[model samples]
Target: MKFAQPWGRQRLSFLLEKAASREAQTWRGYVAKKQTSQDADVSPAQRDEAVRWLTELHGRLQLYPETLVLAVSILDRFLAPIKVRPKYLRCIAVACFFLAAKTCEEDECVPSLKELAASSNCGCSPSEILRMERLILDKLDWDLHTATALDFLHIFHAMATASRSGFLDSIGLNRSQHLGLLTRRLYACLADHALMQLRGSVLALALISLELETCCPDWLALTIDLLRKAQMDSSALIRSRELVSRSLSTPRASLPPNTVYIYHPLQLAAPARRPLGTMETPRDQPALPQAAAGEESKAPPPSPKHLAHLQKVPLRCKASTKRKVEQMDVDDFYDGIKRLYNEDATSAVHEGATPGGGAYSGGSSPCPPLQPVGAS
Candidate 1:
């Protein structure tokens, strides 16, 4: 995670070299050729739509950004080898996303096939996704760890930070924040099929170079060093930088063509209209008393039936007498005992009952009243 470190330079160089080689071997220009023809199997517009779909699913599932980039790479690579119809593009896209999530995310973070299919709403069943997954794996030869543009973006960003510490301090962003901004820009560039012509290393370097020019004073020097390290041509980096700048600057359409907007008004009902030929006169209108008119506007009182429905039902206590006595507080138990003694004393004084009959006497009670025992 430490971007300003010297220990990772060798690893960064190796990653850049691997990504460049794989891109050269696998990347194709099929989108450009099919873009102009309406009957083409997969047009650039369709590919862009598919990529957008994968981006949305990535956010919806809360997967890592790397997963999204890897998914798009898998989709593009799969499309290069096989011709997919526009209708099946979404199914293919979902399959790629599923594969990427399994590869990049932890086992627990990866969604089940049913959940992914249902949540993505790509009009694909779990069976269809499973089948497409097999197809993609076969076509890709089960190699889903290919480096993408995001990988290069990370390398260049780390190298920039390592070269000049606090270069992004002026912008008030830490290394990760600035790198996240660059990652989003790189994702945006990926959505445009036009940038597909550029290799992953070049595209990522272009985005990084664009960001560096704005903040870093030695941006040109830094970019030159990255180009040398990545072994990318300066002309290609220049072209891709222009495309990335334009792509980020341009706003894309937010909604699809088939989108429908629904509106609901707050009014209860519309006022009734008079007949076209009707003429209203003062004498023809009925006169209403002030009290009646005021009453008419007020809400009516609830009926007896509604009042009955609103009444609360009392809950019944189910405790037995012994249970209730066991649960009683000490004060309440002593109070009850004192009341019984007073009642017995009062009865004996009135009726002159004998002490043997469990009555109270003046000098000494027949038997001392029992005291309440505290529970342990």
Candidate 2:
């Protein structure tokens, strides 16, 4: 005789509740008061630059999406209390991600320090990264299990799939397949810094709405109320849902096709798409030149393009260093992408197009209209 499965709606809810409590502990740790005197003098723009650098670095390394999320959470928690110069921030991010990989990824999957240095191009040395790792671990008192938005996603997905409900039937999806798509879309949202303030559960719940909304327009309002009952701030949940929705809808050339999500669990999903063979460093743009004996290399400052992308708001720099280009705030950037899709969808709707040709057309993946960011 077969044993009964221990999963169902009630069981899943109990698990989510437990995970939420654990996640709250992690959030409290993240939001703990920082010592003002030791806090970094850097602007939000500066911190965003560091986050962007890590985004590119994680992409090049072809690490799992959760690795990137864990790395960023680690970086922000470390940076919250200490003041480091702008130049050193990139090194700190590299170290944070490296440490995070060791915790979240398999031994063979984690990239070596030399590989990371080659991939990043920001001129961080292995020694510098190692030093930063030590500093981060000690500063946080050696706790590496900080809960992240991805953590909550795992619980939520398991619950939604455990039962054979009308919700899944109405959407016309396989439990595993849809969960994979949702996970990919969830990773896309983590790329933005604006939604970083929302809790992991709130973000996960919003993503559920985002995926379901394509088929069930009424689903979002219902989800909003459900999350509110779970003790999330209603206003914040709505705003987070919108941001997640926008990020998912944005069209980026770098997004992965849906096939990539079919084979693995979210935790061990395939690595992001990467550049062709050979991880050689470029000679012309070395960020850190080799140093003399007994000297450590300094962290290289961010490139102009990277800095501009992260600045979200315009800054008045000296003429010698100014960039004469239009500035798009982070919110506007995602919103702009979202708007493009909306126009196309609107036009298709007006034309009375069928499902395949319409905005909700099932293209490469049934996940969402939003593309998954490429591994690199």
Q: Candidate 2: lDDT of 179?
A: 68
For residues 71-100, what per-residue lDDT tens digits would candidate 2 score against the true structure? 878877787776677778788888988888
In angstroms, the error of model 2 at 264 is 45
- lDDT agreement with native, every candidate: 0.74, 0.64
Give each model a TM-score.
0.64, 0.56
Model 1 lDDT tens row, 85-177 = 788889989999989889888899999999998999989899999998999999988888776888778877888888876678989998778
The per-residue C-alpha lDDT of model 2 at residue 220 equals 58
